[model samples]
Target: MSASTRSPKLRVATYNIRKSIGTDRRRRPERVLAVLRELDADVVAVQEVDRRFGDRSTALPPEVIAEETGYMPVRFGIRPESLGWHGNMLLVRRDTEVMSTQRIELPALEPRGAVLADLRVGGTAVRVIGMHLGLLGLWRKRQARAVLMCLEALEDPLPTVMMGDLNEWVMDGGCLKLFARHHHVAAPGPSFHSRRPMAALDRIITSLDLRVEAAGVHLSPKSRVASDHLPVWADIVPAGPTAAAERHHVAQSPLI
Candidate 1:
């Protein structure tokens, strides 16, 4: 599509930094930031961003992120030293306006949570949810429902996008089925085990009001070493009037 005919697009990405520990078992926060720079996303959802010990300090320091990247961490006030709730973090470009932020607790065998932000990217208002689901299938399903419930309880229903390290190995079953019932689920590609990616554990899901123009797993030399899981990104825009009408029709149509 030509520039004039194409709608404005926002690039969103999700990466599980594994606490900035690379496949080499080295803690390299700068390497993670370098990979993020390569993606050049408008907003990024990062998982395992904090150390799991006492204080739970962020792996990527706010000052370092501000100085090295074009993005800033969305502050949720969950903890003074932590940049995210649980291990989920959201980073938006410096030009984006964060209207509100929320920390959502999910049902899991271990402690797991999600971060939500209402943002104005350029002139478009959007809602972004970043999460790291549990390892077990049952907990993942319950967590998916909890996230959806949180979204429904919100007042303003802006064009929504949820992206993260889902920890789900399958494509059609598990928690993905729950998300697919209400949203467009896109597993860009296999992003797990960056050395030899064979699992599509990273994903980006969008509401019907939005359209994904392009989505893929970012595979670069830096990305391969940045973490155990590769980053996934999607270029999304508001659905055109015709597309929106068709989506509404599909929603209203009876199941076969």
Candidate 2:
């Protein structure tokens, strides 16, 4: 396959919406959605999706998101009975069929969970896991531990990508080391504490075989403080000269 014929490229986004209550004290889901639309990503992982108790965030609903934007949403949470809505969500633009989806519940100061989606994009199947860790230290570490645990148990050899509001600005090599050699960190696009932002919390970490084509932070001027953290975007291709081969090697290779 020519370089162009290699794996299809994809742009992904990770955003933490602080329950749609922006600094302006207005609920602006459309503005927030507009910012996300600007990213032009094939998929997105969102945090702080307020509506745990089945309240509406905006005039638009999850089904409306698909109708308006053509991206399907997959969301999950551990708390079954909560007035406030909080959870992780995965939205995909292509015709995606979930191979499997799960919620990793964390024992943190506030309950949190993850949403994993297996997508079929351009005839290519890839796994994308979206998560939001707890705010407290002990809880965060446990959540991170759960992340590693999930990584180690992949049944398929196909490449995978994990993105979300990790809530950790400092990289101590613990979370960084979880990925294998072919897997690596993309650009260090800072995306946290959106108001007068100063730290890097939102991120996109991919398999070593993946290379970031373009990565950055995005905050719409029209976007109010619906969330504390801004959204991050990245366009990526499978990395390395043999990334395509490795991707196809799963069926023939013993590693699978």
Candidate 3:
């Protein structure tokens, strides 16, 4: 098939719901669901969806997700009521086929981890990694490398995308640099401190085989108060032959 005739672009997004606790200190899962509906992304990487204590149950229940949004959580939770592994969850549109899923444990001072899913969206086959890295710079760097190693070990080389609350503050150094060495790191603008975002801690990174067409932080009245961090999204497509030739050139310039 020709480049123009390939599958339609896929919309991917990441959000840190802060365990459904908004800036007003209210645990409203419905408000988070409203923000997800606004994003309308084909694949969403969500962080802090579960409570930290007791059973670690999900703040945004699966039943609510299925009924409120056109997406379904990719089940990777060991606990029956949790929606993800270590508060990191991946949600794909209901029609998308989930071929396989894996829970990746990262090196961190805290309990940090990532979730990987191989999915078939429309006619395109892609791999999506959702994670929340540690707050410390050293641990973030190590976690970044660990996630890359996991990708390298995977047999199938699908157009890959990694998205989540990365927790790295600096725009050009540390974990961002480590990921930039192997992938096209994209900062879709500031999404932290949602009331007045000044930190681009949330991010979306894509492999060279994929081209990011459009990207930005989703800002709205509801988004600003739904969580402590806003949502970020990227529209991507498989890089055609011509795009593949310019991969190196684009890789040098991170923001897309």
Candidate 4:
């Protein structure tokens, strides 16, 4: 099969919903859901879906999200009331099959967490790491190293993606350097401080098995006010059997 005649494309996105609170200081779950509907991503890694205080319950209940967006949380009730662990959540389209889900603990100055989900996207196994790293640069670097170690321990190295609010300002150096060495850090443009939009805090890093065809920040009337960060999306095609064969063939060919 030719590159143009492959399976349907998959869209993955990451967003920090700010606990469903808009920049206007209104906690409206409906508005956040509206923006999500517009994004229409197949796999979504969300941060700040839960409140900071009290029981850390979900701002938008799982049931409400299911009914409104047809997106099911990868693993519901990580805590009795919380939809995710340490404000990191994963949502997949109803069609995607979940192979496994696990919570990752990191060395952090503050309470921070990451979620790893093994999913089947159009029959292709894909691994997703959703995380919100610490604030300080050094802490962020340590957190990134922890995440890399976790990925290394996986039994099967599937087409993996790591994404979410990394909170790192410098692009070339800082926390991204280690991960960028092995993974493709997507530059989806500036997505933070949704109103003015100056920094690219939210990011997606992928392994070589997946090819990013298109990527950008999703901005709109609802997104502008939905949260402090804008959602970032990427359209990717898995290196399936046909694509893999094509790659092998190219590598073996010596003559021009």
Would you list the clashing residue pairs of candidate 1?
none
Provide the clashing-pair count of each candidate structure: 0, 11, 0, 0
lDDT of each: 0.89, 0.65, 0.90, 0.86
Model 2, 211: alpha-carbon shift in Å? Answer: 1.5
Put down candidate 1 lDDT per residue, 142-202, tens digits, no spaces: 9999998898777666789999988898888899998988689987999989999999999
* Candidate 1 ranges beyond 4 A from true positions: 1-7, 242-256
lDDT per residue (tens digit) for residues 1-256 in model 2 = 3323535887788877666556676766766677667766778887766554444342235655765576767645444332112467777764656677766655567767676667766666777888877666666777766765665566664567888877766664434444333355664565666776777777787765677888888866743365677888888776765766665553343321
Ranking by lDDT: 3, 1, 4, 2
The alpha-carbon deviation from the true structure for residue 73 of candidate 2, after best TM-score superposition, in angstroms, is 0.8
lDDT of 3 by residue, 76-156 (tens): 889998988999999988888899999999997778899999998887888999999998999998899889889877776
Model 2 ranges off by over 4 Å: 1-7, 52-60, 77-86, 107-109, 171-182, 224-226, 241-256
- Model 4, stretches more than 4 Å misplaced? 1-8, 239-256
What TM-score number comes out for model 3? 0.93
lDDT of candidate 2?
0.65
Per-residue lDDT of candidate 4, residues 98-185 (tens digit)? 9998899999878998999999866668899999998899999999988988987766667788999999898767888978766678
Worst 10 residues of 4 by lDDT: 247-256
Per-residue lDDT of 50 in model 2? 57
